[model samples]
Target: MNGESAMPPLPEIGDLAARQLVEGTLAPIVVLDADLCHLYVNPAWGKVSGLPASAFLGRTLGEVLPDLQRPDDVLRDVLRDGQPREATISGTTGVCSPLGQRLWRAVYHRVELPGQGTCLCGIGVEISSLRRYLDDLETAHQRLALLDAAATRVGTTLDIETTCQELVDLLAPSLTDLAAVAIVEEEFTGAPPPPPGFLRLRKTRGVAPPGMEWLLRQLGGPGPYVDVPRGIATRHCLDTGRPWLGNLASDELFQKVTVDPERTRLFRAAGVHSLLIAPLITPSRPVGVILLGRAGASQPFNDDDLVTIQALADRAALSIDSARRYSYEHTMALELQRALLSEPRTPHPAVEVAARYLPSGRSVLVGGDWYDSIPLPDSHTLLVMGDVMGHGFQAAVAMSQYRSLLRTIAASGAGVDKILGEFDRQVAQLGLDRLATCLLAVMDPGAGTCTAASAGHLPPARVRPDSDVEVLWLPAGPPIGTGLGGYESLTVRMDPGTTLLLYTDGLVERRDTDIDTSVQALETLSLPADGPLDDMLDTLLARLANGAYEDDVAILAARQRDAHD
Candidate 1:
């Protein structure tokens, strides 16, 4: 501020050249003395930091940048140690022009003036763009992880409630801020209408003041009513399957629909300026919107933020679509599979029955494997386990038809062999050769006898209550629908405490592994020969599926109830 030109403008080299290079590059430039005072700042500094050159001149770093509020210790360390400090410092020290105040990663460089009496020089670079990209990558990776986990978790659960609960749990950590997933029941015609149960925030994150629910209800308007003002983001998301962004004050669309003055007050109180919403569009129609609110002095959502959040929402939409489809198909398959499974045949006068079925892993197919235990009018019981070829809706359909046919045949007073023959003939007649295979058995509780017939299905294993495993080797006839000639059935006497294990090939046939080997492996597991049929079957499945089952299975276990015990 004093002697002009006495501080000779040296050759455009050394410190001068460096300053010229920084100034010409369009980045803010600052020269710091050893005491951290602002010796010189380029014109670009005023544009970026929003501080006029006259006000910034000759001022101490702390005095000129009071908004930064950087701790005195940090400055002392930088000055005393003569080391350049570079970090993404937040808070007031991070303040910039009104436009650049959102988020920024700053890079600081320090170089010592060797012969210039221990003075130091420093510079800063803005890296907010780079940080944004990295954030986007991380968000995408997390969304994919959620999708994979949902698929696995949903596959194992039989009930929709459990599946949805598991899905919410999986999404919690990533979308921790998600308010809730309300099941919206809406009928969409040509007109766009609010979903029934309009805006029920089922789950809330973060803090909640008293009457938060009431507030959200007031904001959303009374349910079953018409004329709700849609936010800019909401309208855009609905009209086009894309996201919408409007800066806080400039979003005129939002003002048009805000009916509640209290809601507006609350938004302003929370400093919420901008809104971004993504609709959960399924293949059928738009379901709901995932809304995000950003409140501050910062500008509204930008192109990059819109694209990034929309990308995340798109993945969520796909996942939601997949989950809905999987759930619907799974429910249908389960109901059909349940129907194919005949009610349990009482093992004795005082018998109890319980059973469990598991389908294949998370694939597009719902397998054709099934089981049944039907009470016969003749006082005997019919136990059957069968696996039709292939896996999927078609396979399941074929299995259902065959199961119905088998039931009818068994009910007609025919022997197991006669029923199996009829089943094969029917399948062949229907041209379902590639879609059928089955085993049928008639158990006489009074005689303690089992007459079994198979069309290339797994043999029933008879386990002796006294630790001896009777591996039955009844020869299997050609699989049903193969047009094989009629076959004879095998009849064997069952001891009072004997256990009969009926299972689909999926239980013993693993990819790249021999069926006999897997069967043997199952036999080796220590399963009690005389127990509750359900318990025995459970142990069998647990032992067989040592890790994971690549195919679906149906298991039926029949054991004489111990009269004395």
Candidate 2:
């Protein structure tokens, strides 16, 4: 022991001046003996515990204040070893204060008095306010982190439903036990805003833990639209462009805000005690609202929580709006692509034709890929497949230009090589900004020969009646709009029922792998045996362009009448 003699002793307990010093101090002070029984306590202790000092003097710590949380073992050791110790302690001891809970940094020192044995003197400084400040600071940090997460994870696609699901997924299992996203439905549909009253909300997404989905859905989670009245929380969030939070179990505002009592009953039945409805609104317009809920005993949403959700909602709203616009444009592009590559008419009836156009999957921009079949007076059918190198609405418009130019030039009875030669000249003369790849095949059923030419495009495939597939290699000149023409034509004899498959590069050109490899893979495909040309096209797409293509695919399949059928 380091100089037990050097340690100062406490004054005699009966000394009036020593008692006055202890009583005058604001800090709670207590003295306990070797048996851990309170030998003395100050007036400050009485003020905090709401009891007289006499109540604790002769009592053990647990017997007098069992609710107080402290390091009991450390206190006992300090008394036993005559050493000093420090600990943090806190509790709500049924005493009223600003915060029902109280906290303290307590120091315990072993004091020895003359003739009297050693006792532990414990002094506690309240630190409840500082602890609360740090707690609030940490909560704020978490909220900003939540917002950053929402910004990164939401709006990952151009799909409206997908964006809604992203928001719901981010909210649930983090800020809420159950969550849903609703939309105004017509906000992106060009419909005018509805008049004030009850508004029908389209459920975009509803999510909860695996087993709780059904319960959430019963509370207007997802699927069929929910019609909300003027005073309803959802409507309040939407109309006012603000959040509406409530305690469904007891909040009187629920009754005051709702025109229908069934809404309140629905919440009660769903066992949702706390609910927060936040608006998903953009500067341009209000998109919709989101609902966050907590079940029994879960922490209710607070002002800080509400602020965090609103920030998340603002981000989600912008993402949803962007996705909606992209979706509309993507749909329009697909429709236009389909229309341009519509079913090729049966050229001269002696030739069968089937064409298909598939836009790049999940791409917001449209591509210019087209196919056509034109009958000439010389009893030949001109089959065309072309691709514009870039993607956007402008590319689709340029593709129409190329398609129309091919038909107009083919009507003059130009050869396959001449048609491409002229196509290049006009594209350059017209100053079309996009470069293009074109493949032209002229089929003569009487001669049983197919003359094909290419302008910087992949070669065509010939599937013989015996199921042998060959890649027809022709001289590929510069792409159109390059103004460099070195076109060449190759004629291959077609046996009866032979199919010439002309397609854009998207059908074969994949990401990462070599172009020649994808082309070689296409030549080895086993087409459906003894079926219509349409089935052959379907088989080709299924085998070659398995899933979403990185680019648009245009396919034109043609064959002269088979003799066996």
- Model 1 Cα shift for residue 399 (angstroms): 3.7
Clashing pairs in 1: 68-92, 68-93, 179-203, 272-295
How do the residues 1-565 of candidate 1 rate in per-residue lDDT, one tens digit apiece? 1111111233333476664575565565565555666656666555555656666656775686665534345545666765666544333333343333333343334455534344434445555556556776886676666656555653244433444355445443344222223223333345466554233222211222233434344445554233333443444465467765545654354554344544666555555566555565666666445555554544566675565555555545555555556667776777776665545555445233455678876564676877777777656777878787888777877777777777787777788777888778777788774656677777786777888887787787877877466666676788888766476788899888787778777677888888887776655666776567777777777767745567787777777666675
For candidate 1, which ten residues in a row score worst on lDDT? 1-10
lDDT (Cα, tens digit) per residue for candidate 2, span 199-219: 877778878866667655566
Superposition TM-score, candidate 1 onto the true structure = 0.62
Deviation (Å) of 210 in candidate 2 = 4.8
Report the Cα RMSD per candidate: 8.2, 5.5
Q: Which ten residues in a row have the lowest lDDT in candidate 2?
A: 1-10
lDDT, candidate 2, at 280: 92
Backbone N/Cα/C clashes per model: 4, 0
What's the lDDT for candidate 1?
Answer: 0.60
Q: lDDT (0-100) at residue 486 of candidate 2?
A: 76
Candidate 2 matches the true fold with a TM-score of 0.82
